[model samples]
Target: MNAGKLACSLLLSLLTAQLPACSFNMNVESMLSPPRLTAEQEQIYQKLQNSVGSQQVRLKY
Candidate 1:
């Protein structure tokens, strides 16, 4: 292969290798404002909080 083509291939392979290390989090809205729970769910959540320390539990679904 020509030098220019070989350089391009090398750069492309390097970029492709880095793809798996990249991540994109699209759940910004959910993280910013979690959904509200129903009455029964809230009761259960309170019980969980009481069982475990409040700081140790985060309901993410």
Candidate 2:
């Protein structure tokens, strides 16, 4: 590979090694702020919010 591409590849590899994939987690509130919505979007967002009050259990084997 060319020098520039090689340097980028090495930098990315080092970054990933130091910070494994699971170490990165997004802050949901900022990612999805309340926005102006149409009727359908509002309805769906309400339904999603309602579901948050309920709990769903999962078994990871």
Candidate 3:
């Protein structure tokens, strides 16, 4: 490759490496919106939620 092409390619690679990568995250819209579950669903969710805690066991596949 020519010197100009090499320089351009290197500059492009450096610029791409320096740029921050985009990521998906839970935003306000998702956080604020309610799933609007029925009473029975809510009760089931509450029961299941109460059963779990911060500490969890990792089962081997």
Highest-scoring model, TM-score: 1
- For model 3, the local distance difference test gives 0.72
lDDT of 2 at 37: 71
Q: Write model 3 residue lDDT over 1-61, tens digit each, in one string.
A: 6999999999999999878677657587866754577899778767666687554533232
* lDDT for 37 (candidate 1): 95
lDDT of 1 by residue, 1-61 (tens): 6999999999999999998896778787756966799999999989998988747887778
lDDT (tens digit, per residue) of candidate 2 on 1-61? 6999999999999998987556545788667754577899778767776787666533233
- Predicted structure 2: clash tally: 0
Candidate 2 regions off by >4 Å? 21-61
Predicted structure 2, TM vs. truth: 0.31
- What does the lDDT read for residue 49 in candidate 2? 67
Cα shift from native, residue 17, model 3 (Å): 0.7
